[model samples]
Target: MLEQSTRSERGSMTGEEARRAVREGRLSCQTSSLAPGYVQGNLVVLPQDIAGDFLRFCQRNPKPCPIIGMTEPGDPHIPDLGVDLDLRTDLPGYRVWRDGELVEEPGDLLSHWRDDLVGFVIGCSFSFEEALLADGLEVRNVAEGVNVSMFRTSIPCAPAGPFAGPVVVTMRPFSPADAIRAIQITSRFPSVHGAPIHIGQPEQIGIRDLSKPDYGDPVAIRDGELPVFWACGVTPQAVIAAARPPFAITHAPGAMLVTDLKNSRLSIL
Candidate 1:
């Protein structure tokens, strides 16, 4: 077991180190601002029997389910992600689902691991959020030390097999000028959910209220600031819930798989 320590101590560790901590039970919390500069991902593990359909679903909806890394059936190591990465434990948290209904949020998936399960790692906004912060744009959720606000939209995802549901999105409030810069900065990292899906009207996207987000904490949207929405990795969680697969596993919202890939490497220009 890794030695448990304070958040401040964990914050200074490298992505690999952070993942080790998670695997050893030394850390289990939202992975938002931790492991800075590395690409973080949303994870979805499913039985091989249904993996093909889910893969197609992600292919059809690239914005919300961009593929970053995938593993062979029952294989936990994604060498391209991290040399020693263990899919069942590298993430800070995991959500177990049965027939699409959430069963539990466990610290690790050790007991649940099966020979037929396959892992899919989708790109997450944390990669681009790092890019935005590097450009001096403030990410409100990070500044306030909270999970990024996420909501479900009425926008329907293209159906594939048993997977189909509304798109899920994460919101960040920014001044008009900053919002423009954000769009430009994020556009360079399409694999991690590029550009704003919607800029100003929250209601237009079916977000009834900014203060009451469906996932993560709500941050204040001051006057003159617009809430910018990005297609989120959490979309798969919604798909899993709606599709009700016999068994599935996913990283808990805001709790991600930290990889050795640098966020800068994900940039196209």
Candidate 2:
């Protein structure tokens, strides 16, 4: 009975249930472990001056940076996200960058709000993770209670003026059978980084060590479990940090924006 209680406490909520919790301030933390079968997004807010170029960057590189929904310049609402969604405060956490350097990490984007900033929602690994879980495969980060580790690879992005940098990927270690299931499950969600780019060879992508990642926390790779890579939405944040635009905003790593759209809606077929 005690073990049952513990398991129930650790159990996650459904997508719509969690979204309502977030709106009510009951669940104001990482959305990763919140909604088991919903879509969560990585966010990027930039000046109208650079948004056009950035759009092209996403266009050129859809795998690592799929655009889920975008807002008009200076607008705070993305109707597709939610009816009451306010870009300034709906999220749990935000990262503010000034002149290309990270300057502040806030609970909301209200103070940093500007008339020229535009919001872009990128399809996140949460979609793919849901697919994996549905196939009865374990996601190590979800199992271990940590952010999925992200790495910057030697691979270059198709340069778009000042927005060019190496592609970044998130790693998850799975057994061979689970890994194959992950590949097939994720392949259906093309908008959210479909399938594995490189599996089992971390060093080939300039990732020197599994324990040391550029961002997020590392998880164990059990015996016979191989590490798999997927094009990550975090790639844009890395690029923005390197490009150093005068001002930028991003969803804090792992604290993604939960949209009204369902994960199933993102599946290409």
Pick the lDDT winner: 1
Q: lDDT per residue, candidate 2, 1-269, as tens digits?
A: 12222333324555445555555555565665555566788889999999999999999999999998899989988887777667787777788999988899987777788899999999998887877877788999988988888899988889896899999999999989888888888999999999888999788889999999888998998999999999988788888888899999998766787777878888887
Model 1 has an lDDT value of 0.90
| Residue 193 local lDDT, model 1 | 90
For residue 26, give model 1's deviation from the true position in Å.
2.6
Count of backbone clashes, every candidate in sequence: 1, 1
| Residue 157 lDDT in candidate 1 | 95
**Candidate 1 pairs with clashing backbones:** 100-244
Runs of candidate 2 exceeding 4 Å displacement: 1-26
Q: lDDT per residue, candidate 1, 1-269, as tens digits?
A: 22476767666878898888887778777776677888899899999999999999999999999999999998988999999999988988889999878899988888999999999999988899888888999999989988889999999999999999999999999999999999999999989998879999999989898999999899988899999999998898789788889999998877889999999999999
lDDT of each: 0.90, 0.83
Instruction: Identify the runs in model 1 with alpha carbons over 4 angstroms from their true place.
Output: 1-3
Q: After superposition, how far is residue 201 of candidate 2 from its true place, in Å?
A: 2.2
